[model samples]
Target: MRTAEQVTFGGSGLNRAAQIRGDAAALAQAMADPAARCLPMWRGKPLLRGDGLDALGLIPMDHPVLAAGLGKAIRAPVFLGLEEDGAPRFAHDLSRWEPEELDYGALGSFVDRSEQRHPDLPEDMAFAELRRVMTALSPRDAELAATAKAIIGWHATHRFCARCGVETVIGHAGWQRDCPDCGGHHFPRTDPVVIMLITHGDAVLMGRSPGWPEGMYSLLAGFVEPGETLEAAVRREVMEEAGVPVGAVSYLASQPWPFPASLMFGCAGEALAREITIDPVEIEDAIWVSRADMMTAFAGEHPTIKPARRGAIAHFLLQNWLADTLN
Candidate 1:
């Protein structure tokens, strides 16, 4: 999809600079060089500035929050570039910052840190705040924020050695954590998830999980079980959720949905059958909708169904599918 990369974190061709991960001295030098910068992640939201919020927030390496986190840092920072403009950008952490309350329509301004301050911040801010801020960001910024949150969250949760049950220390610029006692190395974990748009002619199958907002639905998705291929996962997820067999599954796109670290594999599949036998344990309901209905949903004109989430691969794929540009 032409707009696939347009998602906030989708196609920013940021230079990840993976080769520098192993060179501690070089990494430290870069951070200290004054040219280096960081982006802020509040909860899991990337900080944005400016009118349309396209102005990505820039955080210097020496910022107080980054210093506190990176001073005892674990992973090397990853940078993303604007695919359209090729400009380098940072993802910062603003979890330590304060927030201002506003109406849903006015929420967009929260991504701009210039609207608030961090004075006497609490030590334990809820992750929900981050979600709120993230919801306010553009798709691409949300993706970047989600990436930072997932990575940082991994560091926080995996501080213990899985091999020997011992405390681990951060290493390799936060990519790996080493167990002090057992000599074990633990890396950030990204669980694989298969999200597919199952099309049978002009209609696509969508489902809603239990507790989702009324009328809200998305493509059926689930984790790739152990020993399963992506194609296999796609078929399994569709069958398990909607009770519909899928064939000719093909890869489409991907997104880093870092709500605790998940890589969503977007796919397209041919429906082998039309009947949906919903699995109450897996999904609340499953239904098929024609291309015209989907277009209406995307436009927020469908009274009973909302569009797939923005910034998510599901929404991205559906948007492209509607435009006939799944190339």
Candidate 2:
């Protein structure tokens, strides 16, 4: 897709300086430097400030919870030193504060006071407010949100040792966790999901999951199983859901959908058979819509079907495909 990276959370080329993950002194300096700033994550959502949504808010290392986590006795919390416009940026989770806004749906309701571990408090932040503020931010702010969400989510979940059932310690600048008892090293987990656009000539296939809103139809997607190739996964998923035989699958674009950490691999697949055979177990219904119909759907003119999500890769790919720019 020509404008794939133009999608929200697609690509902004932030320098994820992984090389400095092991440099304790350097990481400390970066965290403490006045120029150093950390993007705060409430639950899995990133904080956004300013109009254009272009202003990225950076939480300082001295914030109460973060200070505790990175104390000398407590070992420095894993932090990523990212670079934007030749300047350094940081990411951290304020899962320690109770966010004031709660109506932003699943992304905004992250208050977990039971953890008492101040780092687990949901910050007084709201996802919808952030979105509103970010609507006018510079491109860098949007990109910074993407990076912060991904890293903070990683920190929130990988707090235990997978091998010994013991509490693990953060290490390697927040990229790794070590279990002292088992000498085990753990890293963030990212699951691979295939979100494909299956097409037969001018029409494309789309469906809605059982739990989705009334008319919300998105490209069929499924997790890529162990040992399965992206091409094979596309074929299998399409066949299982719509009973369509797909051939000549190709990569389109990708997005980091960090609801809990997932890499959405957007793809395009050619349909070899068009006979409609909906798998009641996999999808509520399957439909083939012509280019014109899709354009209507995108424009909110279609009465029965809503458009694919705006910020998602599916919407991005479909828009480009309609414009004949999927090259």
TM-scores for all candidates: the values are: 0.80, 0.84
* Tens-digit per-residue lDDT, 1-327, candidate 2: 566677666566777788778887877777777777766555545554433234555656676655533322124444555665435676665554553444435543322212111323244432333333333545566666755666556656667776778888877777787898999998778899999889998999998878676788889999999999999999999999889999999998888776567889999999998897989988999899899999999999999888876666788888888898999
Error of 2 at 149 (Å): 2.1
lDDT of each: 0.69, 0.70
Using TM-score as the measure, the top candidate is: 2
* Residue 211 lDDT in candidate 2: 69
lDDT of 1 by residue, 112-195 (tens): 233333333222222233433544665555655666677777766777889998888866665678888978988889999999
Task: Please tell me which predicted candidate would have the highest lDDT against the true structure.
Answer: 2
Could you tell me which 10 consecutive residues in candidate 1 have the lowest summed lDDT? 120-129
Query: In model 1, which runs have C-alpha deviations exceeding 4 angstroms?
Result: 1-8, 51-54, 65-116, 120-144
Which residue segments of model 2 deviate by more than 4 Å?
A: 51-54, 63-78, 84-86, 99-139
